[model samples]
Target: MSTTNKLLAGAAILVAAYAGSSWYVGKKAEAEINHQVNEINAAIATQLALSLGEGEIKLNVVDYDRGWFSSKVNYEIRIKSAKDEQFQFLAQDHLRHGPFPFAAIAKGHIAPLLAYSDAKLLPTKETQPLFDAAKGEEPLRAHSFISFGGATKTVIDLAAIDYRDEDGNQVLMAKSEGQVDYVRKGGKEQADFTMTFPSLSLVVDEGDLHVQLNGMRANGSITEQDKAQASEGELHIDQLGINVENSTQIFIENIKTASSYEVKDGLLDSTLTYDFGKILADKQDLGQMQLDVGVKRLDYVMLNQLSQVDDLDSMDEDELLPMIKQILVNKPEVYINNFMLSNPAGSSTLTSDVRFATTALDPVENEELDLGHYVESLNADIRLSRQMIKGYFSGENMISSMADMFFNSAAEEAQEAGLVEYDGNEAKLALSFDAATNKLLLNNKPISVEELVQILFSMQMGGGLF
Candidate 1:
């Protein structure tokens, strides 16, 4: 062969080799992606099985298609009771992911990535109408994103959740969008999530009673520093208005609330604020009302654990009381840093710190403990405005009548002792519990248990408990 012919043959061989190597690399990349996805599906199925407890679950992989750099997967999940003839829950999901880079897999790392996924929740034939209504609103779409092996973030968007029947028509309409981030660090998993309902409205209409909630927008986020122990979160609402037309008419407008909390090392700190911008009853503007509260050193972890009882629905009182006692004994100190309520009338403030002296707690010995024994360690401070009382009792309700009678009986004593002053419209009182004498002091004056009971009885009976 001539020199030119030999050079052409060599070029052809090199091109063929390159093409074959490319095909092999593509195939291997596809296999690795498929394997990871299948592992995820299997883990999901296992979790569903565990969550079902006594119920049964079935997972079906409907379709899987692989491409050179992309893949699609479709699956369905169904659950049914052991005795039931029909499925109790059902959902179908479709996922499309990738531009899988062979280089990343070879390097043992997958960088920032996103997958598009959507789902449909199927209802039984009996509840078809409700499900139809939901689907008619919009399809549920979710997108998953992963960033540098740090966390998997999922974003979901939905139009509405609605239902209708002859007895009542109910609907929750909103542009609901949410994001959830799951991260793992040091053998512990945490989640930080946020959800927003931009235009939320809930309405219920029946024969005579028609209730509606409108102009409700809310967003919230929760961050768990330690899932088993600590978390911090906040929720904010823009506005919520409610109207009820029935035997009694109620109208509330511009209701807003904001709350946040933090927990770490067995101590919890929290703050909450609520505002009733305006309230109208029978078309009478009551006024703007607001409340604020701050708390610290609360046993939030124990409280959360106590709230999350295993199989609580199946546990009877005989099996529950001891659990409650144990939880109370293990509870840590709680301090109310500040609590204030303000309205058109006036404002009241309260602060308190309380803790249990668990000298009597013996979890293994099964000893019955009385919480009252620990109450004597609490310390409290209170301040109230006389206008606050007058505004509360000024109405023509039954409570006002009781308050009037009680105040009349105490008028002479209050005047003689000069303990009640209306000029400043404010009153301050401090309370402390003395363990040595087992006495409770009010304004540095020790009061007997009987006297305390009478005072509390008068307050409750006269509608002063608020």
Candidate 2:
């Protein structure tokens, strides 16, 4: 054959091979879709059981039309809430079989893959309102790149919304987008995702109310480990503003939250932190505040079973009390690692640690619950800066005046009762409890339980003054 003919022949052979592989990949993609549906259903069942029949969810592949190099799939999702309210959603997917799908190649994705899918939520009678809110656009759209190695990278987009009513009420939402990368192997799964929303606003002309939130972002990761799940996440908002009648305005800046959960030695540990960077009311600075709280040594097994209880309200008290006792006997610890507020004047701080006893209790023998028997030890400290308190309550506002008076009265009463110790620039309270010695101390001064209870009761009755 001539050189030109030989080149054409080689090209034809390559095309044929590509065509064959594309068909094979299309078939495999269809099978994988079915397998994933089964997995989803299994997960829904497990969740339902664990939530004690809180809700029901099921996903079904209603149709799959497989072509030589592409396929169209339809899916239906049914959800029944704990309140028995039912909702149905439909999704349509266009899958291009790959080894080198045309769409992927167009995007310069050359590596081999099983398929690329473009999916969109379809409108139904129940979802018409959602569609209308999106100005007739689909509420959600997602694109997925599926790899032969059972991993998927997906990009999801949520449509922006602009809605108004005859009553002069309006709501506007900016488009939100997210990406998820997920993989499951050998009975373990991992997923990471990040999402962003530019802004959301609601306005009520009649009430002169306007609420605006801007620059919201969230990122998270979940991983399965040894039949357990560990996860961590953070959420942040650049600013949140609320204005009422142009007179009362509250603004919060850089609101952030972080949380984590993990398992260690068959026990669960978790921590959560919140930071409100700057809070302002009517343009007056209200300082910044943060809280960090954590729990350790939680009996994962007992808690897991407790979570799976079919129905708590209907369960016999005889059976439920013991389960709770068993959980408390595991000696879990709770910590308020840091609770702080800072401003130009000064700072206030509070910290606490409480632990439960490991000793088991017989509910049958002890008809009435005594918290002292289960509380192993407790330690808490509070330091209030006098300057900070004065600065915070010095605003020329009715609310501030009331708060100032209340704080002054409470401080005087507490100091007189020897519950709070005052230093040069701060007021301090240190409380500790020991179950072994049945001792309670306030400001390093021993106090009887009865006396402490009476003081607390007095505070409660006398408008929260000690």
Candidate 3:
């Protein structure tokens, strides 16, 4: 054959192969739509239950149109909260089947995928306000590429909002975007995502109230381990400010939060930390603060069941007692690993760890609960800088003066009574309790439970200290 003819034949063969594979993928994609929707619903429900305690989400396919190369699917999403409040929304998805979807190719994403989908929220009576806020643009849009290996990478965009009410109330949001990579295999699902929001503002003319947040970003990931789920995330804001007419104006800078949850061996552990780099109120600098807290060895099953309860308030003591006992049987530990605040004046720090005891009392045998017996141990340390305390209450206001006086009197009395140890510049308090030994110590000095209770009661009754 001539060279030109040979090249033409080769090109034709390649085109034929691509067309055949694309058609097959389109058929496969159509067949899997319902199954995928079910999977998505299950995942959403699980996530909602974990995060919100009690909620359900479902996605139902309303229409599907299949073609040789692409398909259109419409879905209705329904959400029900723990309060039984329901929200419904509609979305439309356009899917282009692979191996070489034209859209993906045009975007320079040519590695061969099962399909690529573009989905957008459709405006409805309930969502019309959101659409109007976005100036008639779709409030939410997502583009997803589904790999042949059952994984997906999706990019989500949130439209910028500029909304104002006749009453002079206004809300504005900058355009935000996020990406998610998700995969499910071997009966387990994993996902990673990141999101960024440049700014948000809320204003009300009634009180001259205004709140703003800027440079907010968050990233998170969730993975299944041994049939259980573990997740972690961090959120950071460059600055947050609030102002009201004739009221204190508050501003916080470089605020961050990190949290994690995990389950292992039928027990759950979680931790949360918050850090504030700078805080200012009414032009007064409050310095910085950090807090870290966590819980460990909680009965995962019991907690999960408790989280699923939609009406805890309706449950009587008789019904709730057993569930509480089940959770206590695991002997969970709660701790405040660090609570610190600092300024140029000085700093204060506190740490505490407390654990619950596994009780042998049965709900049937013991109708009345004795919470003291359920405490395994307690240990805490507190260190306060005298300078810091003084500086905090140094303002020339009636409240500050009264607070300073109260603290001075209390500190002197407490030190004299040996409940608090005062160093040159710092005051320290250490408390420990052991249930097995039936012992309680304050500042390393043994104190009977009765005496401690009496001391606290006396302090509350306006006594200096005991």
lDDT (tens digit, per residue) of candidate 1 on 67-177: 433445555555554444455444444433333334334435465233333455555564466557676754355655443333566777765766666767656565678
Tens-place lDDT per residue, model 3, 369-456, is: 3435667899999987767766665555676667656666777767766667875567788989888887889988898777777676
User: What's the lDDT for candidate 3?
Assistant: 0.83
Clashes of 3: 0
Task: Find the candidate with the highest TM-score and give its number.
Answer: 3
Model 1 residue pairs with clashes: none
Candidate 3 all-Cα RMSD: 3.4
Give the least accurate 10-residue stretch of model 1, judged by summed lDDT: 414-423
- Which segments of model 2 are wrong by more than 4 Å? 1-16, 30-53, 56-60, 165-169, 184-188, 204-208, 263-266, 299-316, 358-372, 397-406, 434-439, 445-448, 454-466
Looking at model 2, the pairs that clash are none
**Candidate 2, 266-336: lDDT as tens digits:** 67788899999998988878899999999887766666666556466887988887776776766889999
Provide TM-scores for the models: 0.62, 0.84, 0.88
